[model samples]
Target: MRIGLFPSANYSAKKDIGPMKQMGDSHVISDVLALGKGVAGSQQVLCLDGASILLRKLSLDSISKVEYENNHFCFGVHFLLEGNYSFVSTESKSRLNITSGSYNLVQWPKTNGVEKLKGREYTSIEVFFTQEFLEDLLGTEYNSAFEKFDNTLVDKPKYLWNEMKPIPGRLRLLLLDILHCSYTGIARTNFIESQIRCLLIEVFLGKENGMEQIGGEATLSTLDKEAIDEVVSYIKQNLKRKLTIKELSEVAGFNTTKLKSCFKKVHQTTIFKFITQLRMEKARLLVLEENYTVAQASYEVGYSNPQHFTVAFKKTMGYLPSLLLTNLS
Candidate 1:
């Protein structure tokens, strides 16, 4: 919802023409619709199986704009087909702006924020998944790509990624079909439900086009994600040390089992593997950017035996460490 050229900044939506169509799980609830003075467009919604799909096509007058506050434990994605928006966080004082043809996964536990919109034409689709529904859908899988969501159970909202990504072409077309669905009654409900599942697959597990990581959805609680993130930061800071699972568990305040599961879930790899990855990445940087010798680079990341390090480097990097040295020679 937006506020612009209205009677007052406090203008609340006083009118909801209500239920233009209601059949089975499909409810054509036209809200904030009916081209008013400053704004023009229709806001329709589809609800099914703990998910809500909001489809809006709006056109504002040249001087019109919409400013609305966001306050909820939101876990979903926002797709913008047109217009630009700026979101301001009241708690962190962070600002994010997104242009057309971009989308972002939102796991806002409590976004005490405001979103501003100003454009001649605005179009967007929002898909929201309930915590229970999402968890059920994910089914306790290991190595899910997305991170944690903003949870109502948490005291306050922590870090949420506002990174904007381009909308995949196929997903965009599917969204358009949803916006202009011609099906009615039970068929409409079934169609929308199928589309929702497809949306999830396309955004989070589309191994076909390699868009699985594109949505950047991570599964875990807010606290667990933060704890894991903290552990990762510490690992980065102390890469030269021989970090162990016990030490990381202490750092994360989680037991070994929980720590291992959560870490793998967030990173798509075990803690040890993640550490190896970090070490290999740092060693590569040292060789390529700092011009460190193979031995020096290996030793710098806690590899005492250069031979062992060489084997590991070759296995992880798909090439021998001495090749880098050969290039230098």
Candidate 2:
């Protein structure tokens, strides 16, 4: 069924309205609803399982109105990597503006919308999944994770729209991995599916547990917030240095007790875990993108022993660094 705008009888048939065709397991109909002398470039890839794992990058050369319609019931988590766009619901007239480093969730039965893109390049990654797919991955835990939508009737699809929210650091890193993945064919598809499942679990679990508002509370004083930010910056900048909690505490000007508490409050992770996460992420990028060997990447990320780095990388990323290189090759 045609879900988006129908071709108007008045306009000439020479106009381009983007692409409307079957994509993976779903049908996507996108049209240039309105154009102000702009060009749009987009790349879309669907996983082997059809629309189960979809990634899209879009760039607009000028102001334009884009409309999208989907014929299936699925949930989408969109990460606005760059630029901003305004979305107006065609059915409800509700409006939302999504900016970089933020994400929004939308559920089906509510797919039609008009997107107003500013004259700038914008990149976004959207991962879509059906309820059955989520259930298969999450099992009984799914109900608890998505308790907010528990009342949604299966027989009558409901529109669920979650306005933009700040992207958590862990989820951001995963999205980056997906964006930078080098594998192709079935390997790429498998990697994407695994990452999507992890992403979904993290998002829903964060929502369920109120992890989204990590540092947005009056409990953290301004000084404490500043200190936490400083500590985070230091960790990122000094990934090659062996940073202990005591050093980090001094860097933040907070005592050990206060340092741990404030760091957890601000980053939703302990100082050690947070540093390890950053190190692993950096190491992954180095190995994948910079052509760094496992030992070299480990040392670059502050791992004194290559064996330790290998174990830690495997534990956190679910595979050894060498395996990643082999897959890419």
Candidate 3:
């Protein structure tokens, strides 16, 4: 399917943005959309196994609203990284405010719209996942959340997850990492693939936990948030070893009580619970991908007793490790 970007209201006749092209071991496409006066924008697109990403940047001296043929598209996240714009759905008569440092989930059917920009420049990244891709990733776990998006075409377009939310600090960092990625060739693909998966998990898991990125999170100082982020990095690197909240507090230069509060504020989970989830995830990969036995996987993730690991695995994954092994084809 082709998607078009137009500089004016004549978008009803504008055609394709061109086909996605692949090179070597990765798929990426780069293009420039020239709208009206001084409104030339550069865009980069990357294709994964089941989803596509679009990173767009534009600068203008005098701005005019740009229209787009919002044909049938995949469900996705819209990350507005720079400037400000509001999308006015022509048919639905609904307006979506897009501002710098804000992100939201967009699931819409075929509807054309005008993008009204409020700043000198605009920069954004969109990650769209096919229905098949979402279903395969979600499995039965997110069945209820998955039902939020409607595939049916309607004369008036509607947004499934319409709340405009501020982008979390962690996700902001990840977006910059992708934008500033310096890797070459296949390593670039691997880097972006891993980053995308982590990003998707953060978004989806937040929904599963019934947690919103509350305004209280802004109460954390920049230095404190960075300190907490560093602690999380440390835990992941040392997951196989014994870890303690006291040690993590020292790492963050906060006392145990402050450490607990700040960590939960930033991550929405306790430190120890986060560690257990990480360990179980690692053990799952070891068993399913590396063919490790359940006992070995358990030991590798820092569990001394396989029985305890089995119980934890069922709680996290909703099934026994041995069962997953036996069922693998």
Candidate 4:
């Protein structure tokens, strides 16, 4: 199941490579592709009709490197859930450091790069789409919304590369859901395809809403920046407590108005929104990763009523907490 571009010499000889021949679709075939020997952990590869999604939670005990040379023209979005890696591009002589809490979108071209994975555990999701599939999905006006790479297309770049953007709150939740999904057979296929469609929409259309351009005239002083960072740390540490802007302002040593404006300027989101995002993220992690009951998680995150918590969780995460529990069970 090796893709022609990413060749590996470390495949287990005992594993049956011929199983890939029985895979009926391209998505399934791509999912089973050998990722080399350094990855050891749970993996789920879903081959949808239009796209292929690979979710891996693995440990890299040794340095793993992959080099590509002018391979297929496809669009890929890689989500780095945990761990860090560095990429050195031979073509541009550029180095990109991909860290946890960030995602990278690239229009892979005829280029060469070395990916150096540190010896640690990593969780990641990668979605790949062919040119025809993307063209069909994006339609004629794609050029206006997406910038090209390397002048590949006559009209514009067929794909766009967005390096190291913070994952939006909803998209993060969706990725968690995909990772925890328990369905199988046709239900699993349909669920994955739907998730991929939503993910693509979030990446293409929802970029502007989540990404803040941090340059130009608006800037924060070093003292103010440190204050905002402290406030963020405080909020995360005290999620169970009822947080108010006034209390946060006191911590930052600023008035309420200045506190709100400065916090938004530094974090690219308002204080309340940031707090809510953190609370929801923590609550979900507790329920899904730590096996906390719904009521316990809700109360731990400062919800007085379970019903109220359910409403807020559904609104913020686009699904009920019970769904996560059900998948976990």
Candidate 5:
């Protein structure tokens, strides 16, 4: 049976909690209505009842007055909410210099500077599952399985080293559905269960942990940036050479897994796609500039068979080589 275990809120049966208010020295927002205004510098993860959640950033200095306001979206568990939140820093800096994609947890230190953000819209849906809930799933084998899961997530609080941006359209819709079922008090339907499982798979397996380009932007880590530069130079210098995962990994001096991940982080696509795109672009130029025949260009670009070349070119460029020539002519 599918179930949602989430944070509790201070929102009452009656009375409007209104938009989140900022208070104290830490410029953090909470589901104050449901979770109550946390004591300043509280470290615990507050659980709010029901699933609906919304949060806006607030300045801790003047939160008691509610005078300051800032522009930001309200995104969280079981709801689509957006609004402005504000807090002005008093010590030295007039405004707190938080950038996009910034997040903090109980353990991890907050990463500073705009470079970490890369201008992406920051949003996250925190999902909490109790050990008891997981134990129920494993039944007789629950103990061992639960231990494994716990070990993996033990460092979860600080695991936000990289942001998981949601993909446009498809994945976002999937998240919306999950939140809807969560707050609507609806039973976990079979279809919804599949969707939830799909999300989990994406998180566990998808490149960059299935992070999509929120606002079509990303923040690259230093390791990712270095790996990207190495991979790009290798591809450009050896476009006509046969390429493989191992070779690419070596060129980047990163393990195969890390190379693939860094490629996705910087380029927002896989190495295979990057190489294929480069080859296809070069082939198009050869056809346009040198007037090479499809067969000639195909072999010159490293494809053994003209048919395979045509298939690859069409898949990437959405036009047959001949058609590309026709358009150019």
Candidate 6:
């Protein structure tokens, strides 16, 4: 593998490492650069048995516009993994924005983009399969799973507040197992393929619905759609300020209950959850990218309580904002 260290950053790759395996074990893994202006970061990309997983460590200030290669399907499994990234469509440059606070399975469209990485530190797992490889596995029923995965594309997919729940836990363990097997030098086989099938079954069968199901519906008219959009847009724009449902209701000209239901249908989350996530994302951006103090950043994001924000930050990002800032700095 050719490892390139560019003018802005340094990278090193070797076949032997202490805690991780090198990329390309029956799959392809690339060294990803931390993009966006603000903090220095590192990314670990691993090719598990039949899947690819990326672990990225970063400070809060990293947010960059990134482009990915074609022909891969990825599942974002971490807290806010599904919620925050913007996946740009190569064909039309149309973007699919994954809002914060959800789990996601992303299918990369068959298009290419300029190879520059800028954004927050994040790790993602991807499964790449050629048409032939998929056909062999799908036989006659391949389309079914594909359709279900596609349905999720229309909007974000729900995950329980925590992944330890039965359905999500099993899938996560299965993924981790695949990673272990690949790292330990397991050969690709039907057994490995079957495991993937089982994982997909669990994902498609779960009662977890898409963002559209929770946020918006067909019975709602165009005006209703417009109203919901306005309220959501307001919330997004004012993440730094204090916002209440009563305030949002006035903006949308709908009662609190109607507003809440509308948000669930279009965004797949309660208004309160959406705001909490917005605050979390804001705090993350401030502490990691802007280099704000924990106290300063906490308040800027609407967490009047620093202790509460610290706990929430650690819970969502899997690391303390202070620690992340130290690494990036």
In angstroms, give how far residue 175 of model 2 lies from its true place: 4.9
Superposition error at 93 for model 3 (Å)? 3.7
lDDT of 6: 0.50
Predicted candidate 1 versus true structure: per-residue lDDT over 63-104, tens digit per residue: 443333434454667778777766666567776666665677
Cα lDDT of all candidates, in order? 0.64, 0.64, 0.68, 0.66, 0.43, 0.50
Q: List the residue pairs that clash in candidate 3.
A: none
Q: Which tens-of-lDDT digit does each residue in 1-329 have in candidate 6?
A: 21111112111122222323344354433345433356455454544343444544444454544444443332333323322455544456554443433345444433444333334444333344333344455567556545434323322222322211111333444554443233222344334555655555455443444222323233566687679768866887787788998999999999999988877765555777667765766676566557788899888877778899889877755667677565355
Off by over 4 Å in 3: 2-26, 147-154, 207-329
Candidate 4's displacement at residue 18, Å, is 9.9
**Model 3 Cα lDDT, one tens digit per residue, 243-320:** 998899999999999999987765556788778876876787677657888899899989999899999878865677
Best by TM-score: 4
Q: Which ten residues in a row have the lowest lDDT in candidate 1?
A: 1-10
Model 5 whole-model lDDT (C-alpha atoms): 0.43
Query: On a 0 to 1 TM-score scale, where does candidate 3 land against the true structure?
Result: 0.54
**What TM-score fits each model?**
0.51, 0.57, 0.54, 0.68, 0.36, 0.47
Which has the greatest lDDT? Answer: 3
What is the TM-score (0 to 1) of candidate 6?
A: 0.47
- Model 2, which residues run further than 4 Å from truth? 1-43, 47-74, 78-125, 129-143, 149-183, 198-230, 242-254, 266-268, 303-308
lDDT of 4: 0.66
The residue-by-residue lDDT of candidate 2 on 86-145, one tens digit each, is 767667666667666467665655345666656365666766666766677778887765
Better of 2 and 5 by lDDT: 2
Regions more than 4 Å wrong, model 6: 1-205, 210-219, 311-329
Q: Which stretches of model 1 miss by more than 4 angstroms?
A: 1-26, 33-35, 63-72, 89-93, 111-113, 140-143, 147-162, 208-329
Among residues 3 or more apart in sequence or in different chains, the pairs in candidate 2 whose N, CA or C atoms overlap within 3 Å are 25-50, 25-51
